[model samples]
Target: MSTIVSARGLTKKYGDFTAVDGIDFEIQEGECFGFLGPNGAGKTTTVRMIHCVSPVTAGTLTVDGSAAGVDNRALKKKTGVIPQEITLDIDLTVYENLLVFARFFDIPKREAKARIAELLKFVELETRRDSKIDQLSTGMKRRLLVARALLNKPRIIIADEPTTGLDPQARHLIWQRLRQLKAQGVTLILTTQYMEEAQQLCDRLVVMHQGKILKAGDPRGLIESEIGKDVVEIRMPPDRDEELLARLGPLACGHERVGDTLYFYCRDGIGLWKALVDLDLPNTVHRPATLEDVFLKLTGRSLIE
Candidate 1:
């Protein structure tokens, strides 16, 4: 449970533009730590620094007791990366792809062969070992990426939007594999925009916006603190806001109007739900407050662009 990654006033810049503003957070060993944000929110930038591919422009960044730097070979050797993009060699067979990657780590020929066999099976691609990367489906390619990352037997794994284009079953399979890795004590550093992914995998996460940390906590704790226990959504015209607020406002802890819907955040939404039902209001829904709710509330529900 010791700190595996730590950053203090961490910052990253590209010439005149700053991609990661001053931010600070710590990741514990053997836990899935997440960086959650929308496109261009610096989640990728922050994690790139952690994995030592991108240089830090300012402040301190450390991983496993060493300062993070572009030339930090020791850190790089023990770290595995599942990049967002599919970086496999399309012309090579599944087995060949892994074979080449193992060489990069200087894994011996005999040992590499043994590990490759185990990994192909681990990702459930044993039957497709001889098949070309181009012949595999998107999910299959993603699984191969997972296997490739593990070839070095890394202590830390950085998964940057690893399940980006996968279907539900494929995504779940990836999740299961990741959980299995975590159970084996691999420190997982994840950067994703998927709130559900963060909630499902992360023991804790930071919600970033405009290159800055807006909030950080365990998912459920953040949801409860920022959004209460339940959410009541009423898809009514905005003009009715005042009328409904007069009657339902006192029963709820907080309320907001976005588009045609009025949202009520309550510690217990049942009472407010009953009030709305008594009013015979149409298009009303009562649901649990989720990480998505906390995300939108803190980062703004509007599109980032």
Candidate 2:
């Protein structure tokens, strides 16, 4: 696959505060590339520049051989954005909402009508076409937002927290649609807080914190490289941590104490489990290491405000 989006030392700032520091990454054509970070990690700002909605303060960002900038109409024309916030006009019916957006793209009435019908069916909102935006449920509204973003046939789609505040069924529906788009060869740029969402869609991703790219790789690879095959959690008092570590630390590849839990990251949990059983610790959990473990370990377990 060819590189569709490339950023080198890309930076974004507001006044004296730097939201996105000098960071670099490349998104290949027809693959789901994700930006994963906690709040205020510049994931949103980075993508805003990619879709040409926000101006780049420094360095270079190019999409499909064209420089990405606020005034780049050609780049914007081929990019579709599903914003984090629901910007639907409640006064208009579902069909009218898409119709107005089609007009923004200068789509002809005949073509717009046909496209709207197809998008509505694509998002499974065909039955709610005539309903007012306010009359639809939250899931229906989110689905409509997805349909609206497709008003213009776009080669690249940027979804910012597309499943925010959605139920399991709704979130799965959106995930399925996104996967379908990827299968159809659309380049997808996603920024989401949901670790499961990133694991489900992204072929590769970067973890950002304090305006820096800390790590980048495929989900499973990152987990295996940074963390091992399994994680053993022992919940106990802080005072007992030293004794536990001295006993089991060598049995595991690594260990860390965060809050009440002592995390033992290891390739095989059998020895660790036997060690724990020898000690007879009551509060212990052995489970497979996941993307979430890598995320928390890289970003820190504390709250990010």
Candidate 3:
């Protein structure tokens, strides 16, 4: 597959803080790629630069082989962006809002209407076409934003924290539409703090922290390779660190103590688990290493604020 988006030594600095520090990655055609990190981890900032809204302080960025700055207008026309916040014209009805986006791409009169109708159906908002944006539910507004983003039939779509404020049902609905877009061959680069969202929607991802790439690969591969196939958490009293480490040390492939939580990563956690049981550790739980496990293992922090 051809590379749709490419970044080399991409860097972004605000004052003394470096948001994206010389990171590089390629987003291939027809792939759902993600930037997974918590707040201030540079995911949003990187997305903005890729969307051509934020200029890179140094290094190179290219969309479809054109320099991000040299061909921004063309790049913007070829890409769709759903920002962290909804930017729709809430005063306009659903149909009108979509039509407006189509017009922005310079679609002709007859073409814009046809495309708008199609998008409404694609997002399952056809029944609410005539409703005002604010009159729609929060989920409806998010769906409309996605529908509007598809107005130009962009090759690449960038979403920044797309499901941040949505409920479970609404989030699932949006994920469904995103899968539809992927099936239609739209390359997606999404920045999300939600691990499940990333795991379910993104085929591959890069987990970033402190303006650097912490790890990048297939979601399951990252978990399997970085942490392991499974994890066993032993919540112990703060002062019991020495004893707990001594008991878990032999079985753990790698383990760390963070506050009251001890994270143990190993394949076949059964052996490690048995050791813990024999030692009679307090508040023990054993589970598979999810994307969440990899994130915390790499950063020693939670994804949510």
Candidate 4:
């Protein structure tokens, strides 16, 4: 796979505060990469630098082998961005919004018209192409944003918090479009707080904290390697956390205590369950491990927190 993006010692600082501490990574063509972290963990900062919308404070970066100092316009043309905030113009119709984006690429009028129609259909917004921006549903607006981004037919797409706030069905609709993009071999970089969104879409991911990477790999690989194969949660009194930790030795290969919850991680959750039952340890329930448990294990808290 060819490298589509690369960064070495990438840093961004403001006065005395550092937003992105020196970090380095590469993204290859035709893969969905993710930056997974809580708010203020510098995921957006990284995306801004990649999009060339924010200057790097230090270090070297390149897109498609184009140096940071060269061909930024050419680079931007191949990159499509969906910012954390909505940027649609309320007065423009759905089709018109995309036509404006195509014009920025200096696409010819006749070709731009064809492209806009195709993009609208790709995002499932074809039926509502004439709807005024304000009259469209939230999901429709998001679809339009996606259509606008693809107006130039970019090779790489950057989505920041794509499903931040929407009903479950709306979110799923957006997810569907993203999957379609991947199936067509478009390289994508997604930053999302929603664990399920990242898990379902990303081929590999980096979990960031305090402007640093805590772990990196495919979601399931990171979970199975950083953590173990299984996790068992036992709810107990907040003050009894320490006691639960001590008693977990008979049931867990490794354990962690966060507030009133005791987490047991091991290769076999059912074995731990049988031990807990044999020892009469007070466990509420035993279940399979998930990305949520992996996040809590590494961060010592919930993803939202």
Cα lDDT computed for each candidate against the true fold: 0.94, 0.93, 0.87, 0.82
lDDT of 3 by residue, 1-305 (tens): 99988999999999998999999999999999999987888999998888788888999998898888734898999889887898889778888888777888999989999888888888789899899877888888888889888888899999888888999999998999899889999999899989999999999899999889988899988988988887888776668777777877778898877778788888889998888778875688999889988887777664455
Top candidate by TM-score: 1
Query: Per-candidate TM vs. native?
Result: 0.99, 0.98, 0.93, 0.92
lDDT of 2 by residue, 149-261 (tens): 87888999999999999999999999999999999999999998899999999999999998999999999999999999999998987898778888899999999988888
lDDT of 4 by residue, 1-305 (tens): 89998989988898899988988888989999999888888999988988888888898888888865434888889889877787898888887888888888989999999988788778787888888988887777777778888878889999998877778998898888888898899999999878899888999888887677788888888877766777777777667666656666666678776677777887778777776676675646776666766665665575553
lDDT of model 4 at position 16: 96
What alpha-carbon RMSD in Å does predicted model 1 have with respect to the real structure?
0.8
Q: Which lDDT tens digits does candidate 1 get at residues 1-305?
A: 79999999999999988899999999999999999998999999998899899999999999999999999989999999999999999879999999999999999999999999999999999999999988999999999999999999999999999999899999999999999999999999999988899999999999999999999999999999999999999998888788899999999999989998899999998889888989998888899999999988988988887
List ranges where model 4 is wrong by over 4 Å: 69-71, 238-247, 279-283, 302-305
**TM-score of decoy 1:** 0.99
Which sections of candidate 3 miss by over 4 Å?
Answer: 279-282, 302-305
TM-score, model 2 to reference? 0.98
